[model samples]
Each structure stands twice: as C-alpha cells, then as structure tokens.
Target: MTGIAILPAGRDDAFEQYKQLIRDRHPIEDIGSYLNDEDLELFRTTSDDDLVHVWGTSVDGVWRNIERNDIALVYHDGAFVARGQVLQLRHDPDLAEYLWRKNVEHGRWNEEIPWEYMAFLTDIEEVNVDIEEFTELVGYDKTYRQQGFTRVADKRLNQLSGEESVKTVIADLTDAGEHIHPVGDEDDGPTPDLADQLQAASTDGNAHEEFEKLVAKVFSGLCCAADWIKREAYPSPSQPEAGGRPGLR
Candidate 1:
C-alpha cells in the first residue's frame, strides 16, 4: 500500500538562500521580466516544490523508500502548501535543464547542477495541512521533526492523540469541499464532489452522521496504522521491507 510522506521545504525564509543562489547563477536584475512581483515573491517565499530540483545525493535511501506514485507533501511554517506524486527519480541533466532553465530565467530557481540528483513530481496540488489539526491528531511526536523524507506508518499514526478530533477537522474541510488537482492531471477523471461523497456515506439520512465514516474512508491508511502494529509487534519470523523515517527501519 502507498503511504504519505512529508518533506521540509525550509524554515523561516531560508529558501531565500536558494533564490539568491539562482540569481547568482544567472544574472538577472528585473525579476518582473518573467513574472509579476507578487508571483516572484511567492516563488521566493513559499516552500511548495511542484517542480523543485533538490540535492538528493545523501538521501538516496530515503528517496528509494518513497517509490513512484506515492504521495509527497512539501511542508513549511505550520502547514503543507504543496502536494504531488513521485513521477520519476533520475540524474538526467537534460531533465534538469528543461525544468530549471525557465525558472532560472525567471529568477525563480538556481542554475542547473548537472551532477545533482532529483525526484520528478507530477499532478502537483496545493493544499493546507493545518499544523493545529495535525498536532491534535498525532500529538507532538519526534516523527514530525524528521527532515528529508519521513514515512509515518499507519500503526504509528493510530498511537497519536485525538483521532476523533482529526476526523472532525477532515470532515469539516470535506463539507466545504474544494476541488484540488495537480497541474498535469487533467485526464485523471472527474474530481469527486465532496457533498456527494458525504451523502453516499450517510445511512441514516443525516449529513453529519455520515461525516465520520467518510473521514475514516479518506484517511483509512492513517487511521488504521495501529491495527497493523497490534497484529505484528515487531521481531517477526519474516522482516518486512524497511521504510523511510529514522528509527522505524
């Protein structure tokens, strides 16, 4: 089963360092020449890595665990601003040139580093994963502090505090249901209507009554992680595949 993975974009305005490096690589004074000032500011300020080319030399193992088609979230400040699926993992210079050159020209990304490794993402979507809601559900575990890539097992997630509260927050958001899709996933199929989904889940003809079940269905992987833990408490006859995250492996 596919798992959700989190990655830190940067803390504070540290991504600014990367922006400045991009400027140094390619000399461009007028940032507005490529995009408006507001967009330029967003590119510099946001930690969303929709088409980000990262330095992946040391984190090869972590990247390996995050297989293609698994979901990835780019997190910064107190929420996740971007989400995508791993499309490809490669060390191709041509791919880097095509993806980064435009951004470099627009003063958005640093110049291409041919030797740097990268993970390509597709179907990138932007969403808010509120820290308060997240903390209430999972408590303050060391798992959140993980950098690079951290995969939280469903079983581990079940150990967090306030599972009901997390479900409530997810239900509330789903009720307001906004359509979210990545840039290139136009052909993926019709986006499900949140209200319709909730209604289908309702058995007693009450909207609120069905919400909890819908939330559980949506977050089944997270809510049921602990069931796997309960069944297999570790040191089994056969060791399962080691995943990302520090000590869990």
Candidate 2:
C-alpha cells in the first residue's frame, strides 16, 4: 500500500467549525438523500473508528491507486500534521453537501467544482513531520504546496517505514488528539525555523546558481592539482603565453 498527503482548508479560517463537525462524528456527506435511511444513518453515525474524510477533484487517480490499507498523510501550513489509512473511497456527487463549506454563507454549497472522489480515512494517527525530514524520506519536496492528495513513491515509502522519528509518532496513535503538534513554534525547538530557512533557501532565485558555484569551488582545487601533475610529468612542445601555461589561455 502507498501513502498520500493532503491539505484541508477551513473556508478561509473557519477551521474551528470544521473541527466541531468532525468531532460531532458527522459523515460530512451531502444531506440531499435524507430520503434514504442508509444515507441518513451514515450521516448520523458518530463512530468513525478514528477515520477522517478527504476529497478533491485532483484526487480521482490518487484514490484509484489507493487501497483500503494505504496510508494518508495530512498537511497544514508546512508540516505533515496527521496520518490515517484509507478505509473506503467513492465518487458520490449527491454527497457533496457533506463537504464542509464554512467559507460559504449559511445554506450555501461550495460549487467551485462538482463532487469528486472522497476517501474514508481510518486508523488515524497524528504526527508532526518536519518538511525537510518529510521530503527526505517521502521524496516530495513541496508536499504542503500541493492542492490535493499525492501518491507516495515506493522507494520513499520504504524509507519512511524505517524512519525512527516517524515510527515514534505513528506508534503513539491512541487518539485523534495525538495527531497535532505546534508548527513554526519556538517551543517545539528549532525544527520549524530550520524548515522555514530551508524552504526559503530552496525557493530563492539564485539557489541553483549558488549550488553550482559551491560545487565548482569544492572541486576546483582537485582540477588544479591534476593539471600541475601533468605539467611536471611532461614538457610543452611550444612556448606558453606571456601569463598562462602552454595550451591554456
């Protein structure tokens, strides 16, 4: 099984309301089909078995490749803020009402797009994965910037399983509350600051040029040494230029 990282927004700062709905054990499904007893029951049910729901138009292919036991990682701001497993996935347009549209005024639905694939994520575990460690292990550098769920690479997935920090966080999954940690906070030590610094450095305009320059600087001495050895071993057939070695300008 693979893993996906998703970003959930709260109607532009209505996160508290969204949290309340999730805490109430609501399915977040559209209520248009209340005529169906099964749908109503699902809407009313409070037992999620630690599952969370994630959906988006961009996740159609992602959910297709995802299986029941595949991992789901959540990102907020710049952190890998939570983790869960896929319990089920479906494309139910009628259930779009179930989506939390806190940004919309009362009784309005978010019609930015039609209802798409939604994944029922269970076995939820919260974690605070630094972006650097996350990218290093997951092989995705800009996970937080992704709009929807992204498939985890197989090689990176194996590497993640062996990570002690990730294991420590995943092993402590006893409740939903455990999945949260402070982001960019000094109290959490220098991790957030370091992550921010790394992000800035990576996004800087001259990052690639600087990296190339650094590489050349580190190897220039070796090249010089090699040239000196060649010059000492053999004499030049022709005289050198006024200020440079033979065959060199």
Candidate 3:
C-alpha cells in the first residue's frame, strides 16, 4: 500500500539527493557467503527508477518479479492517456490507489526480499484539461477507475495546447455550489463540471449510473480495439506453451 504526500515540488538537486538517500547498499562487501552471481547481477542492473527483473529459482526455492507503473495505456482514438484519472472515478486519490494496489499477494519490502533490489514508484496524471478528459468518472458513485497505456493521436496534444479540464470541472462544480469554482476559477468555459453531471444525473434518475456505465463501455471498446494492434504488429505463434514462455523456434 502506497500513500501520497502532496508536498511542494522540489528542484533537480532535491530529486538527486533523494535518490542517493535511498541508494541500495550491501551490508557486507566482497564476502563469498554474502551473495551469488545471479543475485549480484540483479542488484547491479536495476536502479531506483527501474523495476528489477528477479527471475529463475530463488536459490531458497520461490521465484518472482515485480514492477509498477502509475499508468499504462494502449492507442485509443489516437492519444496517450494516464491511468490516474480512471482510478479517481472510484474515489479520492487514497481510495483510488487502494483499489489499484489492492490485489498484490506479496509485499515489496519483505526482508526475505533481496537487499540489493530497489523498487520504483510512478504516478501517471494528465498535465492539462484536455488530457484530463482522458480520465473520467468510473461509476455513478466513483466505485471504480479506468486508465493505462495509450497513443493519443490528436494533433493538439503533440503540440503544447494548454487546456485544463480539471480547472473547467472545478469551475463548474464550484459555480453550482459556490465552493467548487475556487478550484477552477481561471479556466474560461461554460461546460458542466463533474459534480454537475453527478447532480444532474441524480435528478434525471438513472443518468448517473447510466453515464458511468457508458464510460466503462467506451474504455473497454478502445482497449479491445488496441489489442488488435498488438496482434497485427506481432502475430502469435500457432502452438502454445501451457505454463511457460513461448518457444522462439
């Protein structure tokens, strides 16, 4: 379980210093009993930002690997979208992350884990309002999130179009209740905020739930279409390995 702290952003010096602070170190130096070839190779190759590849036998028996990305996506409607927004529909940041990492069976920091192995943490978020739309409500009550790897093709994106939907959302939300706009006062738009949809949908009776369902359908369709890209780019072999890696030959 990871917790997010909204501290002020820092300089490159601070980031580098933070990296050094968490640099992996071996308790013992050059002792034959300390480690083995594969283990040392694992440590030497992986960095603070890179997900370590720990494959093969554990030497003690169990073998495993772990990696994480704040967001992943496939090409949908020609764009690259972050995963954080999808999760937001489920709840606030805390609740959203709770659901994303909820399914892991093993802890990354277990002492049993290799001391040389370092973990990586990343958060994928939209930079502007337009990008924010790539993220949306998960359900009527924010029950689930949707996000991942994507290749957004809209030309406006490749260019630095400074549109911020978040600002738009907050503006509309606040205007409706006089409290939400404080968050979105800068943007110029008459569009409805997310809360507006929730309220309007509530009044419309079924619109709230219907809207969320529509979101899921749209995302699923995009993902399904993107899968075909991978299939076309790299066709799968006919025979399959039941529980093992595919054979090259």
**TM-score for each candidate, following the candidate numbering:** 0.40, 0.47, 0.17
Give the per-residue lDDT digits (tens) of candidate 2, residues 62-153: 55766665656665566555666665566776554455453223323556655356665554555676556656545666543545556666
Ranking by lDDT: 2, 1, 3
Winner by lDDT? 2
Alpha-carbon lDDT, every model: 0.42, 0.44, 0.25
Candidate 2 lands at a TM-score of: 0.47
Tens-place lDDT per residue, model 1, 68-105, is: 65555566666765565555456555544543554333
Worst 10 residues of 3 by lDDT: 225-234
Candidates by TM-score, descending order: 2, 1, 3
Give candidate 2 regions above 4 Å deviation: 5-24, 27-58, 101-112, 142-145, 159-249
Q: What would you estimate as the lDDT of candidate 2?
A: 0.44
Worst 10 residues of 1 by lDDT: 225-234
Error of 3 at 18 (Å): 16
Give the clash count for model 1.
Answer: 3
Model 3 stretches astray by more than 4 angstroms: 1-64, 69-114, 122-209, 219-249
